[model samples]
Target: MNENKLKSLTEALTELASAERYEAELILKADPDTVIAQTVAAVRRSFALDIEKLLTEMGFLDPTTPEKCRQSAEAGT
Candidate 1:
């Protein structure tokens, strides 16, 4: 995803988290599995992209070497 979209989504989630909850009784009417899956996907998309972009900029990844990338990850790069 582009940086602008990523930033917008991040801000939106932050605001929503602090806002008062909507009527949970209405949301609870949906399938529990669907709700959980959607929530997980939303969180993962923004968080994963943000971390991946930052790490890539820091040169911790070796594009041509899987082992190098694994080592960097292990070493907490």
Candidate 2:
């Protein structure tokens, strides 16, 4: 990824991690398996895209070969 997009995504990841941590705490208190599962699912959706493909497309992760490129593409970097 470019510098700007990388920064933005990094910030977003931090925020998302914080939100998930809060939700986990709440889940602990509520003791509801469904709620906990749902909360986790929500967090997963926030970063649902492939990471390697995203990294490659964004130019964050550099691939060494065609195979690596395909892998990253499939991974959504």
Candidate 3:
């Protein structure tokens, strides 16, 4: 995977948030869980990580292991 591309998604997400806060509020209020799921899925697919690839990386899903591409986000911190 192109690590730089994955990093770009994060940068884009930040810029999009600043530019479209109202739209984001609507999407979140509609269905919080589904919105979060879709956004994460989009990020993964954006980096070309399909269902099989995602499952393969499931083992590294932990906070202590920061090397994993997928990260757990904490809000209102």
Highest TM-score against the true fold, candidate: 2
Per-residue lDDT tens digits of candidate 3, residues 30-57?
8988697776555445444332333344
Q: For candidate 1, lDDT tens digit of each residue in 1-77?
A: 67876676566556544431342333456766568556556555655555555545545434455567779999999
Error of 1 at 75 (Å): 29
In candidate 2, what are the lDDT values of residues 1-77, reduced to their tens digit?
A: 36889797687657656866776788778967667767777656654444444556666667555587679999999
**TM-score of each prediction:** 0.32, 0.44, 0.27
User: In model 2, which runs have C-alpha deviations exceeding 4 angstroms?
Assistant: 32-77
**In model 1, which residue pairs have backbone atoms overlapping below 3 Å?**
none
**Clash totals, every prediction:** 0, 12, 0
Give the TM-score comparing model 1 with the true structure, all chains together: 0.32
Q: Summing lDDT over every window of 10 consecutive residues in candidate 1, give the lowest-scoring window.
A: 18-27
C-alpha RMSD in Å of predicted model 3 compared with the true structure? 11.4
